[model samples]
Target: MRNINEGENESKRSPQSIVREVIQGGQSVMSADARADARFVESESVIAENILSILCVPLIIKERIAGAIYVDHRQARHLFSQKDLNFLEAFADQAAIAIENARLYEELEEARTRLSLENESLRREVLVEKHLDSVVGQSEAVAKIQFSIRKAASGNSTVLLRGESGSGKGLVARIIHNVSPRRNGPFIKFNCAALPETLAESELFGHEKGAFTGADRRKLGRFELANNGTIFLDEIGKVTLAIQAKLLRVVEDKEFERVGGTQTIKTDVKIIAATNLDIERAIDQGTFREDLYYRLNIIPLVMPPLRDRKDDIPLLAEHFIRKICRDLGIETKHLEPGVLDLFVRYNWPGNIRELEATLHRAIVMSNGDTITRNDFYGLFGDIVPASPDAGPVPMPGSLLNPVIGKMDITSDIYDEVMSSVDRQLIERALESSGGRIREAARRLGLAR
Candidate 1:
């Protein structure tokens, strides 16, 4: 029963009321006539509300009184009984359980959210480390390139990577995107040279259903897939003039329509274009548009050739050796004494790519744990000459003159002459170095 004067009743039923007594005593209180009961007769709320009957029971959970349930009736005395109090107490027990369960569920949800955020942070850390490790080098050129990568990642401007083939331009492009603000977004890569001219436009901008002869379904383009992220266009210099014009509109306006579609799709993608071909020369020949070149050249990064950074050869070799060995499921191998010296002296025409391929071949051909100089013999075409003290080695052309027309017709003359020259050269170096193999390799300019 509710009090007619609730505010005044609350003030009157403080420390010495029926509900308060049940809570403190942890027991039930049933009054047949609350207005005349000795315990509530002096209470102002009981007399003012003319309460005839009252029942109050403490809600107990684990021997603790959480609260009290109070019921009363003014029209009739002895309205509530022991049976009603018993039912309410049982219901309070289930209510308390439900309250505790709801609290636990909230905590579990909070913990799940926290753990998900931490996992995402850890994933980004591992991704950055993997990309940085791929750019293996210790030269000043490499240091400069790393600095440029950081600068390029700081903004949303288009980037142009210029270098020869196999010089790690693609690797650099990925690193830039991984460390940028768009790191959490998608990174889409496209090779312009891989697609034929007839299909280049549709491949780049996608096509609507039935747009062409075999276009059966609608397709999403790389730029659409790379929205709010990055798109790396490899061999951008090879794109034809017709595609270049469409590419210019996307770069400048960030909008394009799919092939044979009227709706213009917009994208917020960062463009990173790379090419081994000289773009300036392509523009001179009217093959590549100059405006598109200028748009992509906002942040240019040049990857140095492996030949120019010779000091990094040993490091690159060690990296590729360990990587290739692990990939092939073989025991780790080390390069022999003279192998690094041989690498430093020769010119790598294919840059870092050739070095890696050569090492892979050497490791596969080698039968032991150590990769010897012989494993790399004839891999770099002609051999380097001996040290200055060992005297000049004859050229293959000059050596062929003395044995001309003297061999049998059935003999492999070229192989026989070159083998003879190699044998003599090794013999002379061995004699000059007092028969010490290590010293002989040094005198032959094959060892440090």
Candidate 2:
């Protein structure tokens, strides 16, 4: 019951009329010496394969014939018998059932795959909405920031965020990365002020085995990890001049060598640096290099401090409340009538960071649904000592006099005060150097 040339030559295929007749009638088709039979006298299959005998059985499923099984015997006379025909009918019924089951299984698998794709798409949409909503407040200040974030996200330029400590600079940096074309890539971050000089270098550029004492194995650096993505260097100004020199090469050339290794590895990365320190002052004092500053400051973005954007305090308070409640699995809570007013009046020395911390504490300590002024003051009252005549909020350089709002001073007086400050600094350096002029100059980081 076989035809060797069935698929090899389309011209040798059985007549379509006979096959269709068997399928439509749900019956069998049999022939002995089909060439001599009048039914297939002019058929191409008979002449091509030199058919001597043929048989076909209809494949039926649920009382309907869906297909047929065909057999041809070219080397024998009267090869097919009634017994053979009956056996072929049973085989065709089993084959039809198997084919239907396989078709049903394929359909089920396709439906499952389609449903899984839809679920994943919905999950991503929800995540993107929640993430963007994290930046609360609709005030002009926040709106401008959103605009800047969107603009920065469209490009691969180096961005330098400048503001007071705890002013949401890190949050803004993350927003920029998420909205950028490199959103799918890694978003690596490093706090330059958190580690010592030795650890800072190794962590930034990675280290090979035996790079230093206790160095057991090779390590990959943040830049390497962030390859083809973005790296956020928080408190960038705190990094030493030595590390800054190596970092400068990455910004310009996009390459670096691992510590204690000679291999010059290359990477494609975008750098976003943030700092609370006065970079210009650091450059003047020789703690930060000017060339490196320019390279990082190509697209400078100044994050507004909490003091300047007090209008958004109420919105921020509610956002934090919702966020804290959701995280702690607690019911949503509200602020008392006077609590928000007091929040706006008191200067936030710690900026948004301090505000979120205060709200988290209030949510935890409060006994009722509404946070009272007492709950808010219990945490921040003594720390700030709220009063109308209180001094301005302390910032990165608040140790010195207020640069923006100071009393009038004549030119001579200003010069005299600066000279006095400079003299005191120089004398202290000389004393520390044991009165050696060259030693004092070196300590002051002066070439002369």
Candidate 3:
């Protein structure tokens, strides 16, 4: 400690400085040396020097020796001892490791700070775009469909969507179109089942002047108007065999002759046809042509029914509820504690459409803000079992009862029948409450 200031100012920073300092100071008690005597070394080293009867040691960091330390006396036959070298080597090894560890720790902290900043930037980007918000649900089926949609949309291909009624095949078609290069073009839709046979041909192909009895002038059909765009042929399986042949020619050759016209009209359109019916079944039944089916099914996309994706039920239900509320100008509604549990438990035959209708009915009938169990089941009439000991039930008299009530009202008794509705409602409300004053008070919003 006494020579530390002068030793730091030394010109040569080699091991000689350490040797000189140790020889001058009595504190240089080196260890780990096997030598019998000590000698003078360089004076510029920041290391311990040999002392007579002391140990010589090696300085190390992380188990790797960087340099050696010497301690004790010099210039004589066996003047210093060997024990000092051993002590110096042990102390140098520990100090070297400590220094290396501290440097590493600082580096690690810097890396962690940089990683945190990168993660924060990624989170902000996701939120700003609202990307994840639009793609909800984690079902493998949904994820697979998303992957396919992205992979198939890179090229311009004719896509066919097939599924059951109420399934979102049309929606899938729109997603494909929106992700494709033709996204900017108009999307046109037509239902083959909605048009009669006589009008279906005229609907798909434009009509010439005086084409039929109702043809007052030339009118463009769906195909002509959908030029340079995408045309969605919904319910494709239902198109007549005659119309199917016509469609095949149009789809294959990109040209069709209008009804009652000789001129061949060419069209530039991307076709995306959708069908709820099974094309194979229609072909087997001789209702649909095989050649037309193959043309429309080039890039087939099948959408599974909603019941198959039970995991997405809650998300889909909530989405429909919000949509219904928005369209109806009604307040937003929430599910009760067990409402979702019970809803998912039931077999949804009508799929998302059924669940959406249920939620709509519940919301419209709900009196209070929160939707409750009673409000959900209020749409249906519940039948109760009679007591075993009770006699056969008898119908009660009521003026408003459709069958027993008087339908013939003259000018004098007209007012009497109209007032019966008010009295019956109050009596029914009291009966449903089991005659409890406080319960009935709450049901009718009467202050207790």
Candidate 1's clash total is 0
**How well does candidate 1 score on lDDT at residue 316?**
94
- Write down the lDDT of every candidate, Cα atoms only: 0.80, 0.81, 0.65
Poorest 10 consecutive residues by lDDT, candidate 1: 6-15
lDDT of 1 at 30: 78
Q: What is the TM-score of each candidate against the true structure?
A: 0.60, 0.57, 0.54
RMSD of each: 17.9, 20.3, 28.5
lDDT, candidate 3, 79-191, per-residue tens: 44444344455677677777677667655654453345335434533322222233345677678667767765667567788777766665666666667776766556778
As for candidate 1, its clashing pairs are none
Please list the residue runs of candidate 3 whose C-alpha ends up more than 4 Å from where it truly belongs after superposition: 1-136, 378-448
Model 1: lDDT of residue 342: 78
